[model samples]
Target chain A: MAVLTDADIEALGLTLRLATTVTVLLLLLGLPLAWWLAHTRSRWRRPITAVVALPLVLPPTVLGFYLLMLLGPDGAVGRAMAALGLAALPFTFKGLVVASMLYSLPFVVQPLQNAFEAVGNRPLEVAACLRAGPLDRFFSIALPLALPGVLTAAVLGFAHTVGEFGVVLMIGGNIPGQTRVLSMRIYDHVQAGEYHQANVLSLCLLVVSFAALLAMSLLRTRRHSRD
Target chain B: MTDSPHGLEAKLAWRSGALAFDIDLSLPAQGITALFGPSGAGKTSCLRAIAGLEQHASGRVSFGSDVWQDSSHRVFLPPHRRRIGYVFQEPSLFTHRSVVGNLDFGYRRAGRPVHLDRDGLIDRFGLRPLLERRIDNLSGGERQRVSMVQALLSDPALLLFDEPLSALDGAARSDLMGCLESLHATLKVPMVYVSHNVDEVARLADHLVLMEAGHVVAQGNLQETLTRLDLPPALGEAVGTVIDGQVVDYDAHDQLIALEFVGGRLWLPYRHESVGQRLRCRIGARDVVLTKAPQEGTSALNQLPCRIVAVADADHPSQVLVQLDAGGSTLLARITRRSWHELALSPGSAVWAQVKAVALGL
Candidate 1:
């Protein structure tokens, strides 16, 4: 028997695409937010940080349920989209991407924040003294110094989004070739009692997860020895 | 000294959690001005305020005619806008860049001034060979050398140094001092150097500002400031005068160099200085002994005919500080009260000041 059926191959491709889009979007959004969170002394920082970390503790179903409500036809966001003459985002690939971004926000933001904090004020001050303006200092000094954390954030975010099942199942409804990701495909095979297909899909998901984590660890060790 | 009437005029008052001080200064525009004091006396604060580093510094600061800060008018130029190069105790270089990258970091940011002699600076600081090396690969002294060259490449109007050599060891300290002296002679830019090392101040400073407990005790020519008898007790061991003497002759047979200053001639152990070259020497107060008459066949290498200018109580009761005029130059002698009374020394009394050692600064 073929290890992966055509449907399984389609699900794997969909999962990789979804993971890649969410990771890129989250990184772009996370860099600035994480930089502000690292450097700001405002009293609101604590509460904002707590809100970003909520997904880490909230069960995936709970977050997906809230997102489902917010994106449902009767919800405020859904109403705004309708007013803009846009389709609602439930049980669709676009909805899955949105859910995954929210679920993986902390995985990307926390590492970047830690990295920015580690790059103390001295280098920035030196840059300022050297006549470098604010933006130049950030891009030329602080960002380069925090590069390792950026890569680690990417790996963790991509891996975490790939492993997600509950949120994708809730918002995407497991439609073949569209919303059925690798994790949900494994679930579909088990439900149909196809042990061989289920085992093949499950092994694929496990191997991808392991490879990602091993890459992150290797990047971390390399950074440590470089320092 | 070119005596430019307007140099750096600053009246600043700064107060932080652990330290505070108020200073009013009119520094020279064309030489190294050492802000001399003990640690925590607000020397660094003064330097920072001048560089616009102290955000809370209130009062007026003007370099020549450019007003850097005026709290009343709410006119404050940020550090980046102020064309000043500042060097801290630690090199604090950008670790991500190599030495060449760091040297270029400021140079390029400063618009790569066409007048800046990049090749000469790299050659002067001996940085040509180390340009491609990583910052971490440098030794402490080499790092400071790079730091200095990095600051200079920025083409600043004024250079502010905050105890740049206090972090160096003996060998590195001398090496950096030599570099500083050479830079002083080569560059026309004014400098504000903050240091507590008396040797460094005497060797490097043309003008001196003495700070004590966040207050200015005295500010004047370097020799006059050091010769002041009324300085705080904290300046006890640092009391002395610097003199510029000409090298007259060298006795290679006996290994001695004859030096001539106003009102006297002296012989020092030879150190390969050419004749007619000016040698700078620091004679500490504690290194001199006053005698009513010169002793024949004495091992003491120097004796100068000078008159007692004044006398004051030394830091200790048993010792007295005496000021003397050697020809046209100034000298100071710290001696025992018993000797002062035995020799009957007073203003206008003629005497010979027997010197023990003369410190040569790099």
Candidate 2:
């Protein structure tokens, strides 16, 4: 029977908030882009697909290094924010969110794009003949049909964000109560030789991620059976 | 809305890869008009263009004064703004929704106040028991019926049926045709039906538009247009003439409906309909036998006095089309080489045509 301390609870809460924010942002950004990738007949599709999937192949440290520089006070993103009268974002919670979004983008986009492709053009054409506009078709036809893929993408993005350490360390800088997510907290406890606390935090994250994946798989299975 | 009484008018030109097509057509505001053509003749493409689904084209489509599309003027109304219902060959019902939910989708999206008559549509289509079931559990015919009902719920000004019966088996097709005829009779909305089946066209269409190579070669009343011998070979050897009739009597014990035509009476198998209902029956060209005088004691139930207006050779072996005028209504009799020679069939020959009555499309 392991009891969680106040600090441990805060770390779990921060982790959940970070993962949720990143997942929501990914969905908002990924949906239209995925739709375009799935439907466009342009010759540049291969190049665009390769660019979107670049983060999946590149090491996390490489992405973290570039992102850290770009978000620093003197760099491009930070300079743009300053010009807009906003605060610099490097070494902050916002910076960690940005890092997680970039790291988990493929996890969100691939499944959604595949789902959109699998829906084919026939159903959409039928919807069009039934007097459905583009947006109405998406909400009434596309989104509902692609629900399993959306669920898979959301859970994968959140789980991938939870396990992230390199990008957060590079950009978020492990500040207590601000940027120290559960994964970072676990790393700190391990470095200080606090094995029990590290084990507890690791188990919590493992249980949450595992539960999310299990729920997603179960939902998909049920949908298949119904069909 | 445009006040032009013509329900639909379109002049569309489109290029897909190397295939370029141009079509111009206008449909009257009432009755079922069929677009009859072979596959690859742009039948589905024309329907899609009218529905506002195919956008990469230059066209002028106006339905009853509403400018649907005018690419030259850069005016286009999206599909949602075009009040049309479409039923595809595949049914295409939403798999995620139950039968009731699918029907409600169209009902809700229609938005404006409409006399939907939802219960009546369900009962007419025999969909009451299947309403609560998920779409995945339905048979092919059930799915198509639900699809038709869903389309009707939208209260569309025009309905497009693109081979709605092409995917069904023979029995299902016959059953669905009855439902479609009922819907056509009750609804005031105009319909554009597409099919390559000539028998189906003869049974349902009031007007026929014949397409070949993306062009409408002929268009007129169904009986007149179909009886023409100059039609394309895609129509096959099953060409026939259509006549509208009323059920004069139904002998339930004999399992037949006695239909009253201008020339004579026709007996059809019991079709789930009451006496006095209007019905369309088709007699194929090959089913009639012409005799110089009234035949006595024959197995055929119908022998009507007819005058041979003309005789033309059919493309097939030893067959000639004998055009006849029976009580001011035009009919065609297809006879083989041996029969034509034996009867010495020619123009102005008054004859009695023997019909077996079983070959009628009731």
Candidate 3:
């Protein structure tokens, strides 16, 4: 076992914060997109879905390269921020959050969209007939019914964000307190020949991810058993 | 009941693909108004249009004086604002919520000013035992009951049922129907009910709207509309007469209620009503037997004097419809061709219509 240290605790906390922040952001951005993707009959839906999924197939390094440019001082986002008198985003915790959100977009969207799709038009129509307006129906009927999908998506996004390396290295630049997430910390420990610390952190990640997956499965099983 | 809006009047027109529907109907707002038609004949579509769930091209839907939809003036109140309660074919309960929570959903959405009489609804629907149960744990009948209660909690101005009893088994369907019948009898809200089942329509509907291919083929009092022979055979086969009768006697030993119809006495199974109470009974054509004379030593309990008014094809190889006059009411008898020939049955033939005691739908 690796001896406990303040640095290790800080690294763990930072990783958790990054993962959580990224997951929340992804959920906020992905929910409406998922709803639209599931319900819309637009001709551009398939192509739009493919574009959203492009990052999943592309190399993580390639994604990180574009993100790096996007957040760089002279790049589009960075320049725009600078023009607004704000600091450029690269090499910061916020940059790491942005990179994690991008890399894990599909993790958030696919589950939510699948959940929305599974909810069909029947319930919504029934709700409408029962005198529920569109917004009311979405919150009261659609959101509650799609809860399992939301949990799965959030967990997957959070876990995937914690496991990211290439994107984090490109944009976050391994700052100890700010951007040294768990996966990057494990990579650093391995490179420095500290196998014990790397094993401990890796074990922690494994246990957490496995627990999340188990909880989701148990919830789904309980739902099916009731039905 | 308060003299608040007592009927539904609407002219709904909508087009989807090659299917275009234009319907004009006025239904008495008190009893069950059945939108009877075959599947895809726009029964559900009409219900949806009334509930404001369907956007019609040029339409006007009004309940009594409240205008729900008017496309000419571009006035359309969405479903929620229209205050119409709708129960779908499927229960469509929220699986994530417990039964109580699911029921509370609509109650809450009804806003702060209008509160549901939850205890009353729960008692009426027999939902107390299942109140805390999860929706997934309830049976088909139980789920439907909860859905109905949920809709009722919305305090709707009109209740629209889109084949609410179609998904249940025979026993459950009857149980649910009984509950609905009592609810309709007690509540002042008017209901527009949709069903493809003739038996269901016969049992529940006071008014009938017959639809064919997205058009209102006929609409009137249930007995009059159903007896029309011009409709498709499936509908025509189920065509019968509805008569309002009073329970004159209840023979406890025999488990029968001797009902006094317009013509004569008819015995039915004991129902949950007292003597002198009015009840509706549906007698299908197939259940009546026409005899040239009053027969004796038969188990049948009803033999009323009748004069044959018409004979129509029964759509079967060996059967025919014998329309007769029973006092002031019309009665139809479905008899085999062999029997017709044996009796030499024809229009204006005076015969006794013998009905078995059990065949009357009370």
Query: Whole-model Cα lDDT per candidate?
Result: 0.87, 0.84, 0.84
The better candidate by TM-score, 2 or 3, is 2
Q: List TM-score per model, in order.
A: 0.92, 0.90, 0.88
The parts of candidate 1 lying over 4 Å away from their true place are A74-76, A84-86, A170-172, A220-227, B358-362
DockQ of each: 0.68, 0.55, 0.59
The native-contact fraction of candidate 1 is 0.73
Instruction: For residues B1-362, write the lDDT of model 1, one tens digit per residue.
Output: 83588788999998877667788999888899999998878898788888887888899999988998999999999888888888887888998999999999889989999899999999988899999998878998999998888888888998888889988998888878889878987877988899999888877889999998888889988988899889888888888878868999988898778878877887776766889987777888988878889989877878888988999899999998899999988898899999998877789999999985343332
Candidate 3 lDDT tens digits, B1-362: 21235478889898866879998988876777889988888888888888776765468888778887888888898877888888988888888789988787767777723446779889989999998898777999999999999888877878889899888997888899889878867776778889998777877777888997899888888877776655666566567777778899999899899888788778888877689987778888888988899988999988999999988788787878878889878888888989999999888888998988899865
TM score of chain A per candidate: 0.96, 0.96, 0.96
- Ordered by TM-score, highest first, the candidates read 1, 2, 3
Q: After superposition, how far is residue B57 of candidate 3 from its true place, in Å?
A: 6.6
Quote the true-contact fraction of every model: 0.73, 0.60, 0.76
lDDT of 1 by residue, A134-160 (tens): 899889999999998999899989989
The true-versus-predicted C-alpha distance at residue A7 of model 3, in Å, is: 5.5
Chain B TM-scores per candidate, in order, are 0.96, 0.91, 0.89
Candidate 3 on A1-227: residue-level lDDT in tens? Answer: 24746677788999889889999999999999999999998998999899779879988889999988887997998899999998888998888888888899999999999999999888887777666788888898898889889999999998888888898888888888999888888888899999988888899899988988898899889877767
User: Of the candidates numbered 2 and 3, which has the greater DockQ value?
Assistant: 3
The DockQ-derived docking category for candidate 2 is medium
